[model samples]
Target: MTVRRPAHEPAEPLEERLRKLEKINRALMGRVERSTDFSGNGFSLFQTAIVLEGQVSARTSDLKRTLEDLSDAYARLEDARDDAEEAKQNLTSAIEAVSEGFALFNDAEELVMCNTPFRALLPDIETRLAPGTPFPRIAEFFSQSRHLVLDQHRSPEAWRAARIDLFRKPHAAFIQKLSQDRWIQVSNKKTDTGATVVFQTDITDIVRAERLRRERELDEQSKILQATLDHLPQGICMFASDLRLKAWNHRFIDLLSLPLRLVTPLASFERIWEWAGKSVFVHDGAGVAAVSGWLRAPSADLDSIELGKSDGSILSVSGNVMPDGGIVVSFADVTEERRASAALREAKETLEQRVEERTAELTREVIERRAIEVELIKARDTAEELTKSKTRFLAAASHDVLQPLNAARIFLSLLGGTGLDLRQQHFAGKVDKAFGSVEEVLGTLLDISRYDSGSVEANIVPLSVAEILTTLAAEFQPLADQKQLRLRCMPSGLYGLSDARLLRQIIQNLVSNAVRYTTRGGVLVGARRRGGMISVEVWDTGPGIPADKRDFIFEEFRRLNQDVPDTPKGAGLGLAIVRRIARLLDHPIAVRSVIGRGSCFSIELPLCAPPRRVEHKASAERLPVDLASFTAIVIENDLAILEGMMELLQERGMRAIPAVSIGEALETLQSLEKTPDLIIADYHLDQGTGTDAIAAIRRAAGHAIPAIAVTADQTAKVQAEIRKDHIAYLRKPIKTGDLFALIRKVIAE
Candidate 1:
């Protein structure tokens, strides 16, 4: 390697040293000539030669040292050259291994070096793209490859011009879509030395993914728009700016009454209009021109036209201009609306005449209605008065008729206990039973009337099923025995939400019906839980009620034709009363039966929490343990009822005192030996209530004493008033056993 010295080393170098040596040799030769000329002596020549030899030896040594310096400088230059070559190879390898196509361009806009990937772009011109290749030439070769896609640049010259324009910018980047659907992100950036570096990264996957996503979104939106159009009430058809039908819903065809042949791929507004026979849009040729003008102009304001068909129907066509210069036309069939409007107009024209006629007719009707209403009011008052009379009669019978009935019942009880013959006793029993039947029928009729009048309200309360069933079992035991049919009362711990009296009456009627119908097998009355309700069912093995007759059996005075004549028939109002009571209590009553098998009558009652413990009412069969000592003050308005009650009490071994009114009861209590054990008074007395009598007698007696308010008036008001004074209540005609049991219960307390 040849080494050149650095400029800063020295102004004079090895050449300067050699030129000085030549000058020294010239001066020595001149000295030798001078010596030879001056003395022509060999000694001078010998001295000069010795000096010259010493100088030569010194100069040679200097030259040897200068040569050694040049060798060392050459070795350093070789090392630097080797390092630069290694660095060039490393840079080449780095750019070659890069994932992106990398190219370096010189300041002269010439390609200096490029990676293999960049060369791959111009595969056919790979060898031509040597170092220092002009950038324009390389770009020209690349543009000819046809792999790059250009935006707004279909021609090759335009794409190349765009690329050159971007290259001139300080820094630029653009996405290049290639043939075969490939993509490249090309970034052109400048280096510090005014050279440009370009990087092209493949983004085919990203571009494809984004495009696919957009296409899917557009497809979904198109489907949604089509669906929306299909569901629109008005018919719709959209036309492109070219007037070709782009989309249409089925309603458009239906409204236009057009044939399917006109709806082919070549369908257009002109074709349909031409086929429309010119009657739909023609208005002396002026309407046609106006419609044609608007249809041709994509930017026209919204317009609408109404058309009439030959069939006397009407169609309203409205057009809207979309942002895309397309038109959406809607067709509305307004035949009914147009006809109705015409009718309304015609009606309006004659409205005054009609109004006058209607007014006069209304006036006449008003007069007639007024007369009819007056008569209706009179009839209503009469009906209401009749209802009131019936209610009053029921109330009157409760006090007057039931008063005698109570007295009669007690007298019959006394008569039955006497020493009468068997035949006399049987007749007495029949008469007594006749009285009972009369009482039952009258009571049932009164109840039915009250229910019909909507006057009976149930007193809803939680009642123990076991207690009610037990009492009913004992009461019906004799009747069951007489009929030779088994009666079973299943004990239940369930409680039911119902009116106690109404509930008992419902059950009693059911049991009676069961016993009356059954000639053989037993009757079972029990309660069972049904979901949240308790069903009290009466199951009897008898000739079952026919499915057809079951509904009618509950009607008034309806009875099955009895085969056994011995089975005493009732008025058949028991089930009727049951139905009314069940309705009053809002309990659901139902019956299921099979022919020749049996019948089950069931009533569903809501289940309720257990009622609070209350003092049990007296058992009708029970009496006071020390009956003789138990004295009762009896107050009654009716003398007959008073006498009978006194006799009954005395018969039960109680000392009885009597009063006809509150004053009499107070006076009787004042004269009593011991404050009466119990005070029993009629609810409706001459001048006061049973509560008033009991209160007066108790005040006169100077202590709180047990009392009972007895009444044949079974009205709720009477019962509530009697119970308000904390007195036991008994309704008439009272059973003898109930009276005794009440007396026993009162005295024990």
Candidate 2:
């Protein structure tokens, strides 16, 4: 039996066929047969086939559902592929963005991928990295040599540490030759799959900064050590165990004055020791073992020592042991302090010697002073004895001397009144002249006594210099003529206020000295202008004073070139009187002389002019003197002077009257016994002065009297007082001629 079936049968549909196969697979078996049979018989199979065709039509619907499941699975597989591609791109970008160079390598040390930075390290290499390129082969192409990757465990120890490869290990360290050399840091890492990653960063600036920092720190430490050593006062040095100098400060160099080659080296100590001495060797620690004597014991150390230099300078030295088996020594010079101490000791010794000598001299001086005291007492006793002797002599002689002088003056006057022959008259004139000279001597002695005893006082007045000179010349002309010396005067019409009598004395003494000393040339009286003053000078061509003795001549009792030794003349009180008077008048006196030629004595005095007029009272007791006849009215308080004046007036052919007071004179004028021709009054009247008496007489008579005043006190103030009455003044011991001449002038006026 043969059988066949339809191709499109329901029982044999493709979907159903696959499902049946799947079902047979699910059944337990090692393997399963695939078939489209439900029953075993071929005819049954044929019959089902026709039925299966119809079922195939229904299975065709299942084909669409199976297509939708396949499309969903394909969509999920596409998404997984896209995610993997994006992750690969992100890894590439991250590698490029990092600053350090980067690369990846395989297990055999072959480059897989390299970034731009790593490519830049090798400009000649291909920009894109690929597999299976030997790392050393590529490195040699760029770096011109094998750039090995480090494998410390497999490589030789020294070479392993130094391994660096620019291509395989992108971060490998490298050197760059710039202005200066520079360094770079490199790092590498590997995954479990044996792929490597490399990183690199340039570190040249940091390395340079570190090197500079180290150098600066070293330099700073060296400077600080050197500066500290230089400031030390003592010499400092270090010696090695081999006895070589290892270090030294500036002070040690300067102390030896060593050369620069010697200064910065260890040999300087030996050179200094050669120039200075073995004394420079400090000798305990720094010195040779021979000098220290410590060679036998290795533990022996330093000792202190002092040495004096050849220049007599002392040095103090000390030594110490160092930890490195060397020695250090120091020295100080102390010469100046020693010298100062020596000088101070010497000074103290000298002072002690001086004190002893001064003490001895002072003792001798005390003994000498006692001797001088004894001599002084004896001299004082002798002076007292001499003073008593002088007092007795003056008392005994004063009365005898004055009585004889009075009698002689009276006799001379009486003889003049009588008629006399020419010879007798000539003898009478000689006697009068001799008596006048004697009176001058007595008066000068009296003046000296009065001046010395402080009894004389100045009577200052204003007077004309012309008048003083005229009066002096009138008194001294005869003496000047007898001596044949011209006594000349320069007219000084100037006036001054001074004691007129004292001024006259000063001038008279100077003039007398001039006349006595002068022989041929004239004596000149003149005045020179001083500041606010007039300096009156008496100059003569006389024996000038010797320069040696000129100052001595003005002293009391000094005489010069005296020829008339027995005359009892000047008594040498003249210049002394002049000096005293100049002092009294507050005038300055000076003398100048030339030996054997002349002398000049000058007196400086303040200048004053006379007043315009002097007022006076009128006298009425006397009539005016007759024009032809000489008449006189004599007023004398003493009867002797009154009678003497009366007799002298009558002899001169002038009528005279005597009244003692102003009232008596008025009564006498009223009686009209005789109207006096000229009035003469003694300055001292009984009731009032002659000046008042004269005024009374003039009032009664109704006219001024041509009166003359007579007084023995010849002081300038007394003369001025009398002259204030507008009358003629005369000094007592009156001369007959002056009396007659004054009366004649009044009558003539």
Candidate 3:
């Protein structure tokens, strides 16, 4: 009857089933004893027990399925929690990577999170700014530690209150200056959860740049104002409201005769006024009071006051007041104008008196006027005679003055020919330079005399312009080379009707002027056709003439003030002489100039056809013949000149015969065994003229001997006389080069 129970069944359920079976058996026995019915009831009870067993197995299966479902749901919930934690960590790392300081606060104003820079911004209270820290407490900590530097005018408590007020309701971003002179821009934004995020950025460099830009603008304005004041014509001085000098110009110092040290900026006006009173203004008793009253006036339109000094100087001073309570004063020197006005008033009064007196004596004056007229005429004639006498004296004394200079020049030339040391040569060169200066002065005087006396005559003939320009270029080439300037002469196949010698002189002077004034570039000589005449122009790259001064430059003793370095100033007579010579030759001279560019001087001469053939003279090269093989006869009025000539000739290894008169020259030539090869005679002899002496010498020699006429007279008549005799002429003081070249040429012919 022991049936096997299922191995998987619960022990408690099985035991309870066994106990219930025993109880049912006992209840069946009792029922059997009590009542013997066992039919339909027994069958119904057996079916009910079977149905209960099936229901128990179904309930056990349902409980097991419910337990498995609960375990799977628990695993899904744990995975979701892990994903949420990783998302939170990523958000924090992103916020910490920002360069700017960052902080977050909850709605209750308690600190939620903060980056390292946020805490570093307030290093003293870095721990206090941790999580859960109240915003008000953080502000209190900053205020106590002096971490935030408010405006200098605000107290810490007031600033903290204001900052808290702003924190409660932030409008926009604001900049705060921190301790140690650092600057920060702070911005606040609200998150979706009602928390606040604060961003801080350093802006010190931007602030510094703004300050520098303002400083540069101020400096530029100051420079412009200073330049404007300096360039003003009038003497200007500015004073501050306190009557201290702020600025002044050099003209102000010069006008007031103020000391240089007293003219500095920030100088007190009182010191300047005292200096002016002592040095510039007349120190009368009332001068000090008057000046003080004028300076201290509140706002007055000051009339120009003329101040007089003990040294006969007058200054006009005017004052003006600015809207800012500052003062400006102007000074002008008016001494000359005042004196002129006084003189004119006195003259006018004197003239009125004289007119009244003359009216009363008109009849008496009429009778005496004829006699006065005659006397005036005689005085005029006497003046004319004196002028003529002066001209004659100058012309006559030119030879006497130049004789010794000529002899000295020849002696110096011979001395230069001899070898010498460097120091000796330098001294000799200095002497030569002295002689050159003397020659220039003498030549100028002689030319002026000759032009004034109407002695220069123009022999107008067909002449080659190229020939003259070429000669000039050759003469001035050395000078141009020394100055490092290019000299160009264009070849012109054209001819002009002009005097060859006078034309040469005019062109030479112009070229010399061009070379002297030009600092760079070059000088060009060329000709251009104008109407029926040819204009020969000399162009130079030099400081040009002002339009106002163009006509004045041709006047006597007129020169432009051109401050070129290392260039020697001339006597200012070159243009004057050129004008005179141009008029004498009937050639028109014109000048065109620009102020800073250059100038062109041109002369118009009537154009003519060139000759069939032009024969140019031989160049002035040294001769091949020995000078000692020739005999030279010299005639002069002065013994010293005659002896000097002999000495100079003997030095040159030439045979020289000296004589003072025509008779002496003839006697000396007759004593010579052979005909004289050359004869040098002075224009004015002791007894007869040099022309007469040359004639006598030629007659005695019985041949037409070559001769030279040396003279200081540059008149056309003297030149004509020498040329008429077919003799060469050299001007005095004679150039050694010319003398030797002429002698060599004559001997060679």
The whole-model lDDT of each prediction reads 0.75, 0.61, 0.76
The candidate maximizing lDDT is 3
How should the candidates be ordered by lDDT, best one leading?
3, 1, 2
Per-residue CA lDDT of model 2 for 1-749, tens digit only, reads: 11222322332243454455455434422221232467678888887787666555544444344344334334434444555567768988998887777878888888777778766653445543455676655444433312323333544343433444333443444433222353456567767787777665666687677556545633443444354445556788767676667668877766645565655545644555555554333333333433244322224333445555545665665565443457667766656645655655665565456556667676564454344345434544544444444433432233333333433454467556665434456766766775675556555654554454444577677777777777887777888898887888778778777878788889988888888767777888877666668788999898788888777787765766644332223456688778777877788888898887899999877777666876788745655554336455567766644655566556656556667777777777887755666677766665777777777777777888688776555444666778887888865456666756676665555
Candidate 1 has a TM-score of 0.47
Query: Using Cα atoms with residue i matched to residue i, what is each candidate's TM-score against the true structure?
Result: 0.47, 0.39, 0.50
Rank by TM-score (best first): 3, 1, 2
Runs of candidate 1 exceeding 4 Å displacement: 1-385, 453-455, 464-467, 470-478, 486-495, 528-532, 608-624
Q: What lDDT, from 0 to 1, does candidate 2 have?
A: 0.61
**What tens-digit string does per-residue lDDT give for candidate 1 at 644-702?**
88888888678888889777777766676678788888888779788887888777778
Off by over 4 Å in 3: 1-381, 609-623
Candidate closer to the true structure by TM-score (higher is better), 2 or 3: 3
